[model samples]
Every structure is written in structure tokens, then in C-alpha cells.
Target chain A: MAEVRLVDVEKRYGGFLALPKQSLTIEEGEFLVLLGPSGCGKTTTMRMIAGLEEITSGDILIGGERVNDKPPKDRDIAMVFQNYGLYPHMTVQQNIAYPLKLRGVDRKAREARVRETAEKVELGALLHRRPSELSGGQRQRVALARAIVRTPKIFLMDEPLSNLDAKLRVSMRAELKHLHHELGVTTVYVTHDQMEAMTLASRVAVMREGRIVQLDTPKKIYSEPADLFVAGFIGSPSMNLVEGHITGGRFEAPGVSIPVAAAERGDVVLGIRPEDLELTTAEAPPIRGKLYALELTGEATLVTLREGATSICARGPAEFEAEIDAACALAPRPGARIHLFDKTTGQRIAA
Target chain B: MRDRSLQYVLLVPAFVIVLATTFYPLAYSLTTAFRDWDLTRSRRPEGWVGFDNFAHAFTESHFLNSLWVTTIFVVTSVALTLVIAMSLALLLRRKGRMHTFTRVVLILPFAMSPALIGVSYRFMFNPEFGVLSNGLAAIFPWLEGTAWLADPELAMAILVLTDVWHWAPYMTFMCLGGLASIPRETEEAARIDGASNIRIFFGIILPQMKGVLLVTAILKTIFALKMFDQVVTLTGGGPGTSTETLAYFIFNVGFEWYDMGYASALAWILTAIMMTISIWYVRMLLSERKMATA
Candidate 1:
């Protein structure tokens, strides 16, 4: 419904800067997720957009209108908090109808909209129940219903589904994707879970201390990470990085060596995801070591190899079996890509 | 001894203390309320008067006057204190070093004894050479040298003011606790949901604060009914019993006039009032808890 733009936005707490000067544009009807670890300023950016936190510098525009001076109510945005933020005193019906009521909606229209929204979230039967009487997932649905009831110009979700159980989180993620598609609202979501960001965001803005490290589609981000941090942060069984050196067009660690396109280097970190490597019967020349640990993950087997001090893990077939200390060999699956990063700067090196 | 009996034994000291301090006086007073035991007329209790003393209270002008005064003081002081406390809590709940210092300073007024507060206000409200009286006169200009403690209405106002000043800070801390229990997200979500600040407070914050406010109002009501310390130290039931609360009336009836039977009856009446308020408070707490976990 509206484009949310942050032009050179910055946030500081006294002398400590929470978010450095930065700019970002969330296209209208796009789902942008700011993903990072705990102290990363992603939430700070979301709060600034919500008008909950004051921007230390620069402008924030929504729908081409500068909202830096406007109070949150004037910004015409709705948020679903991490805790759902349901009004505990009100029943689900009232909670969903609250936004309309604030705009002076009549009783009949309010009730009709409330019922329709409740049914959308599959919460019609629980409309008369208070938040205290609902389970965690049901409470999350109520929060979702509340935000979508009035169809504001923007939706700000601060890790809305992080509090649910593992199984419920997946289902809720799907529901959120569907909701975004249905509403077509410009949404800014903040979260630390990379998986959620990868699935739910049209573009994931991976943030570090105070700035976005990479702003790209999830597929592009996973395939071509901007740097060492992004390379190691995105994947499930994160990209394996073994430190040694790139000498004579080869990446060499303690017990591993790989052919690379990089020139001779003294020290570098070689990155490879577990899924990109294949386990073999100890006849390869790339990764040769003692089998450290083998884990069966239902669909695949994770085999870790250790020699002296370094360890590397590879995803093998589910039927793959090995003795704990027996010799192991792993090689890049024919067309897999390898990543090389400089040791000192933590920036990816050309390969 | 077994653990079961030891638990009972451990409670013995507390039970004895309660029996001696609370129940004993209550029992003695109930017995005295039914008898003509004027200390000036007899060394011990006189013949049983049945309902005479209790009935006399319904017709006694002074008793009725004290009841009316007490009602006025309780209603005004409790309402004012609750409003002031909740407002202070809201303002002081902001995140800042200055707000923290202000919250810490709010406890000082509540820490002072109510009797001490009364004495301080008495001195401060003096028409002559009093800082508050002269300062107010200076600000208004139309009024100068108005006798604050000598006028009935003004005296009652000062009494209520002293009580409110003494108690608002404590109630503010309670309100702070209640406010703290509400997640900040609720208010922020409301704001993002397009509700104005005033709307958020009245519709969201206040409704959630019902239990705390109710308990504060009832507790303050009981305290106001038993407001005797300030009456003694500040106004001395001054300006023709304008500030004479029920507790002070009972004290006067018993010690001042030596009307022991009537005083005992009056004390029972005050206790009954406090008990009724306490029962209501307990009921509210139960329902609030039920709503919380429903």
C-alpha cells in the first residue's frame, strides 16, 4: 500500500550509537525482513519506522510523506509485537475491533469486520475469550487478526512468530506469507532467526552492528554472501570455514586441502556448506582426516572429519555409516562452488 | 514432635500475639459497648445497658457530625490521592535518571508518620508567619492573611490535604507496581494501532489498573475513617469539630468525656465500617485474580 523509506537514519543512546547513519527503501507491497543477532539494531530500525523510537538523524518517509515529526497514531501503521501485545482486559473480538473503534467505526460495521477478521485467522470461535484463556498460537493469531482488521498503510511486525513452538513457527510462517500476499501491505519485519527471514522476506537485509551488510533476495544471499559474516550466518548447518592458507592456487588447512582459483596467499578461510561436500571411501585428495562424529538427521547423515585441530562437516546420504576414528575423505560435489575469505579482514576473497 | 504438630507449635507465638493485641481489645470493647461503664461514674463496669449505647449513636448529634465529617474527608482525600498517585506513577515511570531520582524521592512523604505530617502542615498552614499561607497569599494577591486553620471549611480542607500528601506517594508506588506489570508492548501496539495517547491511557491502561485502584481506594477509605493522629496534632478537631473524624470522636467520647460505653460503641462502629471495606477489597482481589488466569 505504501513505500517505507529511511533516508540516512541513525539512532544513538547518549554516546553509544545503536544504529549508524543508513538508508533503506521498502518497495510498496514488499515484505522486508531485517535479520541479525541480538544486539544488531534491526529492532531499532523497525521502532524508528513505527515512530516508537526517535531517529537521531535523517528522514523517514512512508507513502512519500515525511513522518519524522508525526506521532505513531498519525503514521497510520499497525504493529504485531513479539509478545502479540494483545489487550489482556479485552476479549478477542474487542481486541480485533479496537483499531476500527479508535477510528470511530459504528457498532454494526465493527462487529461485522471483527467476525470476518476472526474467520480469516480461524479465530471466530474464540472471539468471546480473553487473551488469558488462549494458547500461545491462538494468542498469536489474535495479534495477527488485530493488525489486519483495519488494513493500515504499513505493517510492522517485530518478530511476531518467534515466541511460538518450533512446529507452530513453521505453520505460522506460512500463514504470515499468505497474509502478506492477501493484504499487499508494505511490511517491515525484524527478527534474529535467519530461517524465518529466508522464508518470509521478499528481501532479507542482513544487519551487523548498526548497518545492513547485505540487502538481497534470500536465494541470492544464500548463494553469494557479501562477506565472511553473511557467508557463515545464513545456512542451517552454517557454511564450514577452515582456516589455513591459500598457497599455489590451493586452499590448505591442517588436514584439508582444496583446489581454488585464488592466487597464492599466506592465510585464508575456506568456506564450504555441508550440503556441497560428498562423503567418499577414503580415496579422494581434497579432505582427508579421521571421522570425528557422525549424526543421522533422518533425511541425511552429517559426517564431521577431524585431523589434529581442524574439523569439517559434510552432508552425506542417509545410509552413510562410518567408524568414529576411521579414516574419512570428502570432496566437493562436481559443480559445487567454494568460498575463500581473507583471514585478517574477514572479507571474502575473489575465487 | 512430629512435623505436623511442630508446624502448629511454630504458629503458637503468632496466634497468641494476634489474640492478645487484636482479639482481646475487640472482645473487651464489645462487652463494654453493652454496658454503662463511664469511668467517671464507676471504677468497674456498671449495669448492662443492652442496646441503649448503640441506639444513642443513631441520635447523638456529635457522633452523627463526626460520621458526616469522616465521610467527606474519606471521599475527597481517597479520590484525590488515587488520582494524584496514578498520575505521578505515569509521569515518573519514564526511563531517565531524573525519573528514577524522582521515584526515589516520592517515598519520603509516605515514609513520614501521618501524625508528623499533620504537625508539619499545622505549622505550615498558620495564618501568621507561615511559609505556605504567606506564599499562597502572595501568589493570589486578592487574599492575604486568610486564617487557614481557624476556618471550618479551610481546616477540613487542610486536614484532607495533609492526609492526601501523606498517602499519595505510597499509593503511587503501588500504582507503579501495577503499571510495571503491564507490558510496554501493549501501549506501543495501541499507539501503532492509531490510538491517541489519551485514548490509550483511558481505554487500555486504566482498565487494566482497575484492581490496583480499587484496592487503593478502599484501603485509603479505611485509613481516613481511622484518621485520628492528624486530628490531634494539627487541628485538634478544630473550628467546632469540622475535622473530627470517627476515630477522634471515639477518643473524645472515651478519654475526654469519660463516656466509656458510648466510646466503645463508636469504636465498634468504626471497626464495622473498616471491616466492610476490607471485605469488599478481598472480593475485588479474588475477582481480579480470576480474570487474570481465566
Candidate 2:
């Protein structure tokens, strides 16, 4: 296994920068995920690392050697595309053995390795079938098997599980994690799915507008987002922000005076996770707001509260005890969970 | 019942026209093939000859040699057309302004009239005023006085060459459509799998184009088999009967030599060969489809 590093790598398509001055280092055997919304340069970053895309500037070093000019095969990296690009013409056996054949591996050893890898992906029975004959999930297994059979130095997965159904996607996500743990190969996975990134990566690189906003463990990124973009992008239901003035160490709106840390004493974007909001009686003046609606999603219910013009969503227990249009108080969770970002720069304020 | 009567009324005129235009001539040819009739003794027929004319047509040196020439022309021209067309398709299949321009230029020849192309090539190989012959002779002294249409081999070479030049572009356009319809992700996947461009071309691109290529080969083969216009225009059965193809030989026997009985037998032979080849081509395509879908 080899660690893959990008030192100030940049990509531009005739002055339209796809990835601008991005740098990242993935440890050997680490599952580092590049997670962002669409058009965030995450896929471009993965493609650059896999040598599928050219690096316009800076060096990409794999296993401590500059691989900027190296071809994909010479770089010893295997990529599993989101489409599960199993060769439609070749049977599962041939598709899995393609890399081995390209590398000049012997037939006897190649077949043995394919068998072993196919078993790892639970595809032994389907080897004789072509890709078109296989199911969606089976095609994904074949794609994974093709990438892993050669035991390349690094595995670059560009949302490999995205093509599978929701149920299969989750199962394959777990399987990919288990496989990565078992093989201990450095893997760089790119996905727009925040949950997939949270579940799979040792370090998730959260990117925005061609630059990385934060690159840290999933827990760290979620708990302490570096900027408004990271705070808004990482979590489900997304972090809700109140655009109010931080007057007298407390944010003030038309009908609200919510608590803010003493340091953030200006116009700021007061951020709160959906689960961070606590519902209280209307009589109590803890940022009073009318309950707009409640949406139940099995595990949790999203409670939308309106204080004047702004609407804030709060996640309560599945059976939320609140009525629509009922006046309720919202108290932001105290301490580190409450994020305050400068409205002008959108950067997190020091507390 | 009224709708059925109306449909029958509409079809009756078309049916009469079809029989008079198509079937009557076909039946007359079959009847003539079995009789002894010629322009010299022109009646419907004198008596039944049955297989006598067939045996004579097969044994005739001129007819057999023309059959060989036609086979050579069809096989060589169709094979060369597919090869050149597929290459042109691949070369211009890339998505760009220049590739689009090249594609348009390549298909322009297919729109030109075949007779016009034959007439043009006739003048181009005139050996005296022909630019091609003059250029070739200037470059190589051996071709200074060579009349390309005078020699039978050279005449047949020019025929196959002109046929390929005119029709290969049509095949190229067909194969281009086939190639363009393939998913771009497939090639990207192959490239990421570390297959070189050459490997991708043979293993991935060519195999995918097989269906369209097969259709191109069959259509070109059928057209090439009836090689007449270029032969009649360029060589006129040439120095001897050496350059006469099966179609030209049939025309010679029926219209020029006035040997209708022999020409009808020759027509039947050509039709039988064409039917066999077509059946084989279709069977091969069906098997390929089964394999791809396997």
C-alpha cells in the first residue's frame, strides 16, 4: 500500500479553474474521502490522483515519488468508477482478470487471484456471466473485484456504490469499509453523499468552489466546522443559520434575542444543528417562535419553527409533541455545538 | 366487411401494376431460361431446352471467366471498402469541429451519382489528358505510355478502386453512427483499466461496430456483385472479354450477342450465388447477435 499526496495540485480548463491550489495527503491504508456537493472539484481531485486527469500545477506524489507525469498504469493505482464500468463484452472472469492480464501475470496465478477476490466480493458464482447478464449489485461487485484483484498500491473509488439501489448501496458501503480494513490499502473515495463520506472515511475532505474548506475526521468536521460552507454542507437536514445582529453578547432579531458567545458580538450567522434546538413552552421566552410544521422520518421528526421572516428546522424525537402554527420557544444547544460565523467573511468566529 | 372491400379495391390496382411490372418479367425470364430462343430466331420460344442452356452457360469460357472476375471484384471491393470505411469512421469519430468537418467531407462522395463517377474516372485515366495518368507517368517513367483501361487487369483494378472510393464513404458514415452511439463511459472505463489505444480499438471499438459493419459489407457486396456501370463505361468488356463481369456478360449475351437463352441462364446463376451469400451473411449476423447478447 502507498500513501497518495497532492501538493498544491491545480486543474484549469482554459482559465476556468476546476481545482485551484488544492493540497491533501492521504496516509497509507487510510480511507480518505473527498466529500462535497456537485461541481465542488471532488471528482476532479480523485481523477487527478488516479492520473486520469492532468495536473495543471503542483506535484502529486504517490509513495513519496512524484507521479505528476506518470500514466495511470505506471502509478500503480486502480479506480472503481461510479458507473461500475465492468466491460460489457467480457464475462465476470475476464473483466476481473483484465488487469492481471495487462500486467503480464500468469494464467494460473491470475485465475487463482480472481477466484480469491471474487470470493471476497461474494461473486464466485457469477464469474462465468457477462456484465449485462448480472444484476446492478452484481455489476458493482465485479467492478470492485476488477479493481482489487491486482492488489494495486492504492484504490481510487469515484463513488463506486452510487449506481446501486439504496439498500444495496448501504450494504456495499459497509462491505467496502470492511474490505478496506481487511486489505489495508490506501483508498481515496469521492462522493457527494454526506452519509457515505461520514460512514467510510478516516478523514473527509470537505471542499467548496475548487478549494478544501476542511479536511479532518468526520466527527471533527461535523462537530466543529471550519467555515459556514463546511457547517452548512456536512450535516443532514443541514445546519440552520439565523441572520441576526450579535448585540450585547446575544443575537437580536425582530422578535428574537438568542444567546451567542461573548466573542461573537456583531452581525453573524448563528448556526445550529437540527438536533441542537430544544422545544419549550410558549410562555417561556427562550427565543419564541411559531411551530410551522413537523415532518416525521422514522428515526427523527423535523420541526420547522418560524420567528418572524426566518424559518429554523429542529429535529426532535420521531413523535414530536408540537402542533403546526403553535407558538414554541427554541433554545440553541449551549457551548461548542452552537457555531457562530461572521456574516461578511462566512468564517467561524473564535470563542 | 365494407372496410375490407375498400382495402381490396385500393390494393387491386397496385397488385395489377406489380404483376405487370415485376412478376410478369420474372416469370418470362424463367420460361426463357428453359427454352431455346435468340435474337436471330425471335419468337417466344421454339422448343424446351431445360438444362441444356444452363450447361452451355456454365461451360462457356467467356461466362466462366466473367463469373471469376465478378467474384474477385465483389470480394476485393467490399472487403477493401469495409476496411477503409471503418478506419475513416474511427479517425473522425472524435467529437470536435474538425472531426465533424471531416465526416461531412467523407460522405460527400456517397451522394455523387455512380454513373457520373464512372464517366469522370474514364476521363481521368485517359492516359493522354488524364491528370492521374500524367502525374503517375511523370513520377514513374514506366507509366508514360500506359493506358490503364487498355489492359484487362488494369481495367478491373480501376473498377474496384473507383467502386471502393465512391461507396466506402457510405460505409464510413454508417460505422460512424454506430461508433458514436456507443457510451463514452465504456471507452473511459477501458482506458482506466490500462488498455492501450490499439488494444481498445481492436478489442472494444471494432467488436462494438461489428453489427453495422456486417450490414455495410452485405449491402456493398450486393451492389459490387452487380458490377456493370463502371465496367461498361470504363472498359466496355475490354481488350478481350477479360474485364466483363457477370452482369456485363449477361447484358452482352442478351442484348449485344442476342443470345437470350444463355443470358437468362447466366442471370439465374448469379441470383443463386447472391442468395447463398446473403443467407450466409444473415446467419453470421444472427449468430453474432446471439453471442453479444449471451
Best-matching candidate per TM-score: 1
TM-score of chain B of each: 0.94, 0.95
Poorly placed runs, candidate 2 (over 4 Å): A254-256, A263-267, A285-287, A321-323, A333-336, B1-20, B43-48
TM-score of chain A of each: 0.98, 0.96
- CAPRI accuracy category, model 1: medium
lDDT (Cα, tens digit) per residue for candidate 2, span A262-291: 654657788889888766654646467788
Scored against the true structure, residue B30 in model 2 reaches a CA lDDT of 88
DockQ for the candidate 1 complex? 0.77
**For this target, which candidate reaches the highest DockQ against the unseen true structure?**
1
Candidate 2 chain B lowest-lDDT run of ten? B183-192
Residue range with the least summed lDDT across 10 consecutive positions in model 1 chain A: A279-288
User: How does model 2 score by TM-score?
Assistant: 0.93
Give one digit per residue, the lDDT tens place, for model 2 in B1-294. 999999999999999999999999888888889888888878667678979999997678888899888888998999899999888888777677687678678878888877778889989998899988898999998989898988888988888999999998888889888998776656766776778889888877777777888888889999998988888877787858777899999998999889888788889889998899999999999987876776
Span of 10 residues, lowest total lDDT, candidate 2 chain A: A278-287
Q: Score the docking of each candidate (DockQ).
A: 0.77, 0.49
